[model samples]
Each structure stands twice: as C-alpha cells, then as structure tokens.
Target chain A: MTVDFNAIPLSQLSIGSSCRIGEIGLNGLLRRRIQDLGITPGTTVECLRRGPSGDPTAYVVRGTTIALRKEDAYQINVFPI
Target chain B: MSITTEKDFLQELNKEAETIRLSYVTKLGDRIIADIYKNAEQISKNVILNDTNKKNWTLKLDNYLTSKIFGYPFMLLVLGIILWITISGANLPSDMLATALFSLQEILSRGFLDLGAPAWLHGILVFGVFHSVAWVVSVMLPPMAIFFPLFTLLEDLGYLPRVAFNLDNLFKKAKTCGKQSLTMCMGFGCNAAGVVACRIIDSPRERLIAVLTNNFVPCNGRFPILIAIGTIFGVGALTGQLQALAVAGIITGVILIGVFVTFAVSWILSRSILKGEASSMVLELPPYRRPKIASVVYRSIIDRTIFVLKRAVSVAAPAGAIIWIVANTYIGEISILNHLAGWLNPFAQAIGMDGYILLAFILGLPANEIVFPILIMSYISSGTMIELESLAELRLLFIDHGWTWLTAVNVMLFTLLHWPCGTTLLTTHKETGSKKWTLAAFIIPTTVAFTVCFILTQTVRLLGLG
Candidate 1:
C-alpha cells in the first residue's frame, strides 16, 4: 500500500490555514483523548498560534481552542481545506 | 420487561461496542459532529462570516498573548505586577492592623490585671489565642484582599485558559492533562480547592496525579511566610520601590520553583506508579470581556477571601492555643516546645534549619498561617505570641537566633516544598479515597522538601558559599 506522501501533518500547517483532519496516526488513550476533544477525521481545524517556545501550537477545533505539541501534532494528518 | 442491572447493561453495551470495528467509534463521532454542523448551517446562515471577523480580533490578541517572543515574558510581567501590588499594598494595612491589635492586647492585658486575673490565664487567652488569630488576620487579610480581587479579575477576563494553553506542552510532556495547570493555579489560592478542581480532568490517572502534586504551590496561607522571608532576606538591602520589586521577583522565583516541582513530580508519577498516556484537552479560551467590578469585588472578597480566611482562622486558633501550651509547659526546666525542637535540631541543622523552625512546621501542620507566629513564640521564650513592628526588627530577631542567608534560603525552600497542611491532606483523602494515595501525597512533598533543602544546604556548606 502506498502512503499519501502529499498529506502533511497538522503541525506543518501555517498560521491561519484551515484544514480537515485525516487519519489520526495515534492509537489507544491518546487517540481516544484526541477524539474526545472533537478532532475526529474530517473535522475542520484552524491553526491559531504558537506558544513562546514555538513548539506547542494552538488550534481551533469544534468551536474550542485546543493546544497540541508539535510531536503530538505530527501524528495528526491533515489537508488544507 | 426484563429487569437489567446497571452494571450488566454497561457490560452489554461495552461488549456490543467491542464487536464493532474500533474505527467505527471515530466515524460515529465524526458523523455526530458533521450532522450538528449541518443542522447549525441549515438554521443559521451567514453567521460565520459576520462573527468570524469579529472573533478573529480576539484570536489575534490571543496570538500575541501566546506568541513565541512575548508570551512568557508577558506572563511573568503580569505575575510580578500582581505580587508587587500585593506586597506594597499589604504592608501599610498589615502594620496598621498589627498596631491596632497589639494595642487592644495591651488594653485587654491591663484589664485582666486590674480584674485580678492570673497572668497565665491572660497569657493563654490574650497572647496565645488572640494574638495568633490577630496576626493571621493582619498578615493574611490585606494581601488576600488585594490579590484575590486581581486574580478574580483575570479569571473574569478569561486569561486563565490562556495560561493553561501556554503551559499545555509542559504538562503534556509530564504525561498529564493540560487542565492540570488550571488546577495548579487554584492551588495557589488553596490546595484543598485545587484538589477539588482536579475533577475537571477527565482521566482518572491524570486527575490523581494532579491531586497528589497540588500542594507544591504555596497557598494563600503560605504566601505571607514567603513574602515576609523574601522581603527580609531576599531583598532587604534594596530601598523603596526597587525593594518591593525585588521581593516580588523573589516570590515569583519561588512560585516558579513550585511550578517546576509540580511538573517534575507529575512526570515522575506518570513514569512510575501512575504511568499512563496523557489525555488531550480542548480548552475553550472564552472571549475576553471587561470584568465587572462589582461582581469581582463581591465574589473575590466574599467567596474567596472570607472563605479562606475562615478556614485558616478555624485551624490557626486551635493550633495557636496548642503552641502556647507547648511553649509554656515545662519538662525538667525546658519547655516542651524547646525540648521537641532540640530533638529535631540535628536533622533540621543538616537541612540548614533550626529545631524551632522544624517544630514550628510540625505544629503548623494544622494551618500554615500560624507558622511564623509559632516561631516567634518559641524564639522569644515568652510563652505568648509577639509581632515585631518592622522587618528590620524581625531580621534582627532572626540574626540574633543565628539565622544567616542560608537559613533564610532553606526556610523559604522548605516552606515552599513541604507537606500539605492538615486540610489539604484531608481533602486528598476524600478526593482519592485511598489511605495509601493520601499518604503518598503527604510523603512525596515532605520528602522532596527535605531532599531539596539537604542538597542546597550541604552544597552551600561544602562550597563555603554560605
């Protein structure tokens, strides 16, 4: 099976870009937690801002602001809407 | 209809869910959200475009607040300003209250003498109970009055979630929910409250981690001690505004250390017994609004300030009386207080604290607000509480008792990292419902306090830095 090489991780999305979440690459508790926060596949997420360290970026998801570390964000595949 | 027990029904539901593909749950969630959005779009038209621009302004402000270059510095500056305001504003009122209370003590003592009452009775009632309560009020009330309102103002303006947002990565790295930052903020007000606030975290493991570490942050009762010591030893050399700023900075540093320890302990717990994956959180940063002054004052003063003060006073009163009894009651020409202090001296010395300080902490277990009073009572050998008029006199008193900068540093560190008070421990017990976990909560911070102080003391002594 060939991977979708053009599908970028959510962490790479520039500020102000709106995108739809694709397959979440994490499983178990982390996956459940992400879904519980309404970041399921096909949901729209907008990149908001980076923190002082520029690693943890905030995103707008389901009318709430959620922050995710770049490492965790890397596991979330998304494409610009 | 057949009767089905709740547990059996839940088990049946779980089995049914398990039979389906796991990805179905994700699909179901997506479908639910998508349908909701579809319904919303059908009912509301052009709402997004109109509000989007207006909301983006707030989002833009949030961007700046949480920006890479400005977020942390801005947070620190705000914290420093709050501390500075509390310190400077509290000083005059505290002094005034002390004067008024002490004068009332003088009047009451003279009245007792005139009524031919015994000196011991007067000492216990007036000096031990009344003085301790008065000291707590005067020392704690002003700062709480100023600090709580300001904190409430920030809360009303919805800045706290931003704080949690900024600290989210740090807490996540510790394998806990980012919401723990908000709970820790509550801990700065009261650890028991913080313990209760941990309920906001949905994951049981993360909630437990939060409950155990809530005591790292000094509560309002401990703030007086931090400020007093920070003022005297940490910044006593400075003058005027700079002095207050330095003191605030020192307290801020102490608070930062507490935050650091919270993270460290949370990380250790997650990697060890409470090991688990961190649960993600979607924190809603509510749009900032102008805080209503009336509600801010009422809620902060009536709800927070008075509530906390009442709790502190309830414990402090009884602890004060007990401290007096210990200081006055003699065992072979040495008061019990001194005897106990003497017994703890070797260990305390190794940690750069004295027996009296250690004993004060032990006696102060009920309420931290009374620790300074207990120390003063023991130090003076007066069998009654005393409040010095000025920081200079307080410094001289400590110096006369052989307190150096190392002692001050160790005391501050110990105070910052010591065991949770009786109330916090009780709250932990209630929250965790496990004697073992509550014991862990008690022991963890106590152990950290001793180890930190020991290392700092030994290092300073070995390096001849002190």
Candidate 2:
C-alpha cells in the first residue's frame, strides 16, 4: 500500500484552509458512501465552518457544501496545499 | 523484498490460507474509483466552462445561513415569517369557506325534508355525515392550500437541505443521523411519509429511532388547531402584522418544544432499546436555484393539499355520522356521547383535558384533521347547536365547556405528542415488518404524551396557577 506519511486527516484541517485529499483509510460501506459524495483521492476540499455543536463541519467541494462529521472526516487523509 | 514473489505469495495463499485474501482486491477497487474521478475531471476541464461569479452569490448567502452566529436566529425568523404568512393569509379564506359550506348544509337538509326523506335518514345523511365532512373541509382546506405551497416553494428553492445541514449536530447528540431532520420536516407535511423516508438512514438502529420519534413533530393535520389556538390566545391585544408575528412566535415556540421532545426521546431510545452503531451523518447542500413558480404551486396544491384533504374528509364523514348517533341516542336521560365523556372524565381531567377533548382524540384516531370537528359535534351538535362562524365563537364555545388557558396549553402539548394517526401506524408496521416495533412506536409516544401532560397538569394544579 502507498502511504503518505505527512498527510493529515481532513478533520484536522483548520477553517479557511484548503487541502488535496490523500488516501482514505476507511473501508466498505463508509468508504463507498464518501466516494459517492464525490470525495476521492486527489480531490480538493476547503473547510468552511463548524456547526453550532462543533462536530460536523461544512466544506466546499465540487461546487456544493457537504456537512461531514468529525469521525468520518478523520478517516480521510489530506495533504495541505 | 518486492519479489517475495507474487507467485510465492499466491502459492502460499492458495494452498494454506483459510480466509480469502482481499487486501489487494480492496486496494484495486479504490484505485478504480480514483481513476474514474480523475478521468471525469479530465473530461470536465475541456467541456465545462467557468462561472465563478455566479457561484459566489450562493456561497455568499450560505455564509450567514450556515454560519454559527446567525444560523439559529435566521432559522427561527424564516419559520416564523412563513407561519405568520400562512396564519394571516388563511383567515379570510377559511371564513369564506366556512360561510359558503355551512350555508350549503342548511339547503341540503331542507331539500332532503322536501323530498320526503325520513327524519332518521335526514339526521344521519344531512346532519351527521355531510355536516362533518363539510366542517373538515372548511376548517382544513384554506390553511393547507396556503401552507403547502409556501413549504413546497422553500423545498424547491433547495433551502431545506441547508436546514438539514444546520441541525446535523443536534441530531448527532441524540445519536441519530442528521438526515432524520429531513424526515421530520417531511413529517411536518405527513408522518406516514416520514416513516418511509427513514429508509435513507443506513444503520438500522438510527432508522428505527427516526421512525419512532417522527410523531413528535406535528403533521399538517394538527397545524390548523395549533395555529388557531395560538392566535386566539396570543393575539389578544395585538393587531395587524404584530398579531401575526405574535401568533407565529407562539407556534414557533410550540415547534421548538416538539423539537426538544424529539431530541430527548431520540436520546433515550439510542441509550436504551435502539442502541447500536454510531449514526452516519452526511448531507449534501445543493446550490440554491431560481424556483419555478408554476411547478411549485401545482405540485403543492395537487400533491399535498388535495391529497390530505381527501383523506381527512373520507374519515371525518363516517366518524361524524357515528358521533351524531351517539350524541342523539339516549339511554335514560343523558345521551350516549355524554355518557362516554362522563365515564372518561376522571382520567381526562387528570391529564389537564376534558372528557370530550379526550373522546374527540380517540374518535379521531383515523384522522387528526377531524379532531376539531368531532369535538365541536360533541359539544354542541344537539338542538341548541349554532354554526361555527369565527374564532371568537370557537373560543366562546371552549370557554363554555370549561377550557382555561391551561387546558388550551395541555391540548396543544397532547396534540404535539400523541400517537401517530392510523395511516402512520400502518406505514410503520409495513416499513418495519414487525408488530413489536409497530406497538413500540405507538406505546412510546402515547406514554410520553400522557406523562408530560400529567406532570404539567399536576404541577399547575398544585401551584394553584390555573
């Protein structure tokens, strides 16, 4: 398997930051659901803002704002651009 | 190291391995997904043109809408405004419908008498069946005709997904998927559909949680009662837009209570019976679009308003006939309807509601829209009955029947919390394919409704406030 040692989970990306998605460590249904939402390897995601409860954060990707919860976001590795 | 050889690895795995080796196969699937996306990007670069400025406007509106600071307040304001519009706008039309329909009832009864129809037949057909259906229509149709279109307009504008986005975390705290909020919104239109919408949740446990708690949100059938009572009580001193705003605020407060109860029940269910996997929350906020007015109006009127009205009228007509019979038939002196209310009075009063109201809810099991009609029939359908003319008359009738503010408050709470209507229960049984789950869905909300009202009634009585 190819691993990017420097890549951090998308959940760690600060608000107003942009990054290129790296290897998604999630498997099976969770991985497939994310893939269906248009988040794939090398895709770019920009952190918009956190929800009032500070768990799910909204992001701009593929011309839409998709809310992703922290745990799910944590599985998707991203390279800071 | 790389040559630990594919052939050697394959031979070892083929001969000795008990489980299938799928690590490489999984990686290959991921590679294929990535390749597809990459190829799509390549094609889009050549064919798709840029329109950064057009996209920026939607993004800009969303900045405040999805922002933590303004999100909650904006949600309340938008909802309040929509409701205010519905309330004030429906008043005239509802009155017109009542006058038009009630007058027709008089003509129908007179015509039946002229045609040499038997008095018993006149009583059942004209006064019992047709009267009740007419009441449901006059009271229900105008508001629905107004409310559904406005709601559908928001839905068509793609604003509802953003609402789901805003409330995702709150639902997360309750251990259900954010998409439950979307189903709950659908529930505001109808709960039967909302239970069906629960299929969108991937995990079984979360789906059940959504289904069970869907009743906490009042459906369209209950909204008119909520709106009417809120306006009558809260709009006492205010006039014009201020009155509308006050009424809307009260309705919004009721909705907030409903939401709070939904969260609390979801929290309990997740920890207790429905506990299992963590909920999966993923919501796509589609770009806001210019809504097509013609399509929005057509769909809302045809699909929501007419469909719901038809169901309510069908049930109400028969229920009205039964109620008329019970109210008319005497067992010694008091009528059967009164006898039943008398029997139920002790328990109903204990819950901060009267026996007639309780009986109405029971008889209205098939359709919540007819609860008001049944209640009216119970209270005044005898010889001294007068036509329901306006809010003032309705208020006077309630006050005559011992309805204080506390009674009003408890009635709203019960309406918000009670068991799902017959259609919703049937839908739940079908969706879950389990009678146990269907019974749980019924038992859970009912228990919640009775307990909440009981505590409130007891507390108020103990304090001597009411």
Residue A29's lDDT in candidate 1: 71
- For model 2 chain B, where is the 10-residue window of minimal lDDT? B15-24
The collision pairs in model 2 are: none
Cα lDDT tens digits, model 2, B1-466, are 4666888998887865533445766677778988888888889889999788767877888888878788889988888888888888887888898899889999997899899998878888877898888888887888888888988998998888888888888888788888888899899889998899999988888999999999998998999889878876657677777887888889899999999999999999988988865656777877788899999999999988889998988888888888888889999999999999999999999999999999999988898988888898889955576887888888888898899999999999999999899999999999999999999999999999999999999999999998
- Show model 2 residue runs off by greater than 4 Å: A1-3, B1-24
Q: TM-scores across all candidates?
A: 0.89, 0.94
Model 2 accuracy (lDDT, Cα): 0.87
Any runs in candidate 1 off by more than 4 Å, and if so which? A1-9, A21-43, A61-64, A69-78, B1-17, B21-33, B46-54, B382-387
- State in Å the error of residue B94, model 1: 0.8
